[model samples]
Target chain A: TQLLEQSPQFLSIQEGENLTVYCNSSSVFSSLQWYRQEPGEGPVLLVTVVTGGEVKKLKRLTFQFGDARKDSSLHITAAQPGDTGLYLCAGVSGSGYALNFGKGTSLLVTP
Target chain B: NAGVTQTPKFRILKIGQSMTLQCAQDMNHNYMYWYRQDPGMGLKLIYYSVGAGITDKGEVPNGYNVSRSTTEDFPLRLELAAPSQTSVYFCASSYSEGREQYFGPGTRLTVT
Candidate 1:
């Protein structure tokens, strides 16, 4: 079973739309990170939330960590075509060095 | 710094053949990791090293081997490659556990 589960496996929206992607797990994490990946490339880190109930914003993107540290959400406001790509959520459990990744949410923003 | 780098961006190996995927990080991070990403399945950890000479298996370590003899290099080896082993391989490094990681462009490997 996947340690983390992401919702909206695939999403397609026109430019200027807003959407939110969720990452959920029953296990608490020491830290949660969001990454965006383009085709044929590695995932690039967008943001990291280490404290529970933390909210971070990077320009138009907003990231929230659940108070329980078991879930996270990424919301993009006024999405642009450049926002299209695969968004993956990863978490580090307290006991290990390996990261647990969610399946990912593929987003396509059309002009 | 180059941060993280991987060699042979693409490769194709016949079944039963063996090859190694090279990974190096110039950042001198103490933690390095290998992960395999299959379509829609996200990235699964193949192996990881906390430091030189200290390696551990991750969630999916079958059919794979790794070694970390130096702080900057962590290579993943595949023995008796199979079709099921075909996927995009990513190398990542972090300063410490639970820290943000830097990733390599990745290597696409196909085993026929």
Candidate 2:
């Protein structure tokens, strides 16, 4: 079973649209990370949230860490084709040496 | 720096064959990890290392072996390959457990 669960396994939106993807888990995490991956490439880090209720904005993307640290969300505003890729959420392992990744939300922003 | 480098970008192995997937990091990170991803799926941790001469298994350790002889290299060995082992392998390095990770492009292995 996946340590983390992501909603909307797949999403397809038009340009200039807005969308949000959620990642939830029963286990609490010290920190959570978001990554974007393209075809034939490894996932690339986007943002990291540590504090409860903390929100971080990266240009058009916004990340929010849950108050209980067991969930997180990624919001994309004015989505563009460049935003099309697989978005993955990973929670740091208890030992602080490994990552527990979510199944990922595949987003397609078509023009 | 070559954050994380994995060699043999693509390989096809017949069933029962043996091969090793190589991983190296130049960022001087102390933690390295090996993960396998099947088609249309997320990465599954196979093995990981914290330092030279130290190693541990991850969630899916079966059918895989790893040795950390040096801080820069962590290789994944598949003995008696099977079709079920076909997947894309990725190597990642991080300064610490909760820190951001740097990942290699990947190694696509097909065990026929």
Q: If you assessed candidate 1 against the hidden native complex, which CAPRI class would it receive?
A: medium
The TM-score values for the models, in the order shown, are 0.97, 0.97
Candidate 1 structure quality by residue, lDDT tens digits, A1-111: 338999999999999999999999999988999999999999999999999999999999999999999999999999999999999999988775778899999999999
Please write out the lDDT profile of model 1 over residues B1-112, one tens digit for every residue. 9889999899999999999999999998999999999999999989999999999988889999999999999999999999999999999999998888899999999998
When summed lDDT is taken over every stretch of 10 residues in candidate 1 chain A, the lowest stretch is A91-100
What C-alpha lDDT, on a 0 to 100 scale, does residue B81 get in candidate 1? 98
Candidate 2 per-residue C-alpha lDDT over A1-111 given as tens digits, one digit per residue, 9 for 90 to 100: 438999989999999999999999999888999999998899999999999999999999999999999999999999999999999999975677788999899999999
TM-score of chain B of 1: 0.99
Model 2 CAPRI rating: medium
DockQ of every candidate: 0.79, 0.74
Pairs in steric clash, model 1: none
**Each candidate: chain B TM-score:** 0.99, 0.97
